[model samples]
Target: MPALTLSRGVADWPEQGYDGWVLLGMVTLSLLPVIRLFLQTLNAGSIEVAGVSLSFAAASESAAEAVRTATLTENLDTPEDMPLERTSLRSILRALRRAHDSEVTVVDLRQGQTWWETRLFILIAGAARRDRTQAIAFVGERNGTPGTFLGWAPPSRLLAAHLRSDPLLSAAHERARAKTAAWQLGQPLPNPHASVTPSVMLPWGTNQSLPPVENQTPDPAFAFELYLQQNLDRPSPESGRLVTIQRLRELYEVFLVTDSIDAQTPDDAWAEVVLTASPRRFFAVTKAGKFKALIPRDALVAALVTRLVRAEDSPS
Candidate 1:
């Protein structure tokens, strides 16, 4: 049997595995700038300011002046909503050309379609390459806020590869490769919801029809596992843990949302969310890559049940 080692502070990751601290740390690091800038924007309310990007900026009309960020917008259009087709992006490029004549342009990587997961990235790259006038830079978002800045496509490929090859992103990348293989080779997709790990999304219920566990009370976690199998696009389960009723308790706090999805392939955009409930009871984690960001599924059923009971008990 192979040995399993786990560490909270260990930054070294295997080709495929989970590290709680790594996940949390990566997110925390990305969040620092977002927190600081958000504070600056809030404090700007009391002070006098002219039209500017944020309270941090002074008016400058130079070509290198502002780095327009898409995620900074309150209602950012998710990749699902964007028209990223090559032809469409080309049209946007032409339109942008006529409107703004500048030495450089900063575009959301999501819109540029150059991020690894987007099917249009390679296509978007061609367009970006052909643009003779303007140089481009890309920015990635964290928790609906902008932070990580991936530079222009031509130079950033190696850096992007390094970041995306990490355990979590690799899981998404591996899945994309498999689906691509299955499509090109016409191989049997034994499980359409297939993943590199036993996913929290649970796609096995269709193949497994075992009789109920005899004389045992229904386990919410087990039941939830079964529930997830019906949808294969959901996030894969974390390594080193079984989905148990006891495990599901972490997500039982009051929450305004109840949804989540896991990235299993390369074509979907990637995002991870951490919702720390009031008073630090526990944190709820959710992610969407190659799909819409959803509420966490690990504790979703429990959270929903909590909400329903609370709603029903209130005075009618």
Candidate 2:
């Protein structure tokens, strides 16, 4: 038998086809483990594979956990028995920063006050500053309180500022005020839930036999009017005729007129309105043109008809 000669050229590889197929099979089998390991690493929270490391799930979970913790702390009332920790201040600040743009109802729980006795505030401007030393600036209105207050309180004191999806008891409060106003004015009490003035009076007084006043024409202009309990602090030319701002441009105009007319006006007059901070309550600084006079937000007889807006033609 002649001695076998080995061919080294590329074209001669097919001659070793059986050995080549076996080598290819072994290489593919070896790579399958690496591919599976890569997939596993991707799915895992934290894993090291073949000199590479991944922590996708771990990082995501950490962020999610922080938010959940903050939310839980905010919603649940702090245990009366448990003492507050100094370290928790950092977490509170973090939560405030996250919820900066949103309004919150802060429940101050000190001095063993019961749930009803505990001071409640609707806080705006959630976090004042980023520094630990800085006090959080807030415009807060306590429940059943007459005036809106401006205060700089430590973040730690804001123990449970629960985020609310709706205006804080605004509709109910407005309806209650409207009913009271109608009784005082001797007009028919409007429907509790009706936005528009009702055609018929729902009998509501000590004696339910009061006759409905005839020829009552509800003025369309004053349809959204709020009957305030007290007059605004600032006096203007149109103050007595006014009942509510009614529009953004009107508010801007009223601010201008008041600032010009009032002797004791702040340099930044708009800041006064901002301090009220409740969306449902428009701070009528002064009155103008059949609009309601300003009073504390809590004393308003109806929900604010107009929202704060940036009007193109608004006075500077």
- Top candidate when judged by lDDT against the true structure: 1
lDDT of 1 by residue, 229-301 (tens): 2222234443223212222122121221223223342111111122222332112122332222212222332
Scored against the true structure, residue 194 in model 2 reaches a CA lDDT of 33
Q: Which segments of model 2 are wrong by more than 4 Å?
A: 1-78, 110-126, 130-316
Q: For each candidate, how many residue pairs have backbone atoms clashing (under 3 Å)?
A: 14, 6
Q: Kindly report which residue pairs in candidate 2 clash with one another.
A: 242-291, 242-292, 243-291, 243-292, 244-291, 244-292
Clash count for candidate 2 is: 6
Query: Candidate 2, residues 192-242: lDDT per residue as tens digits?
Result: 643444433434534211222123333221221211111111233322231
lDDT of 1: 0.30
Worst 10 residues of 2 by lDDT: 301-310
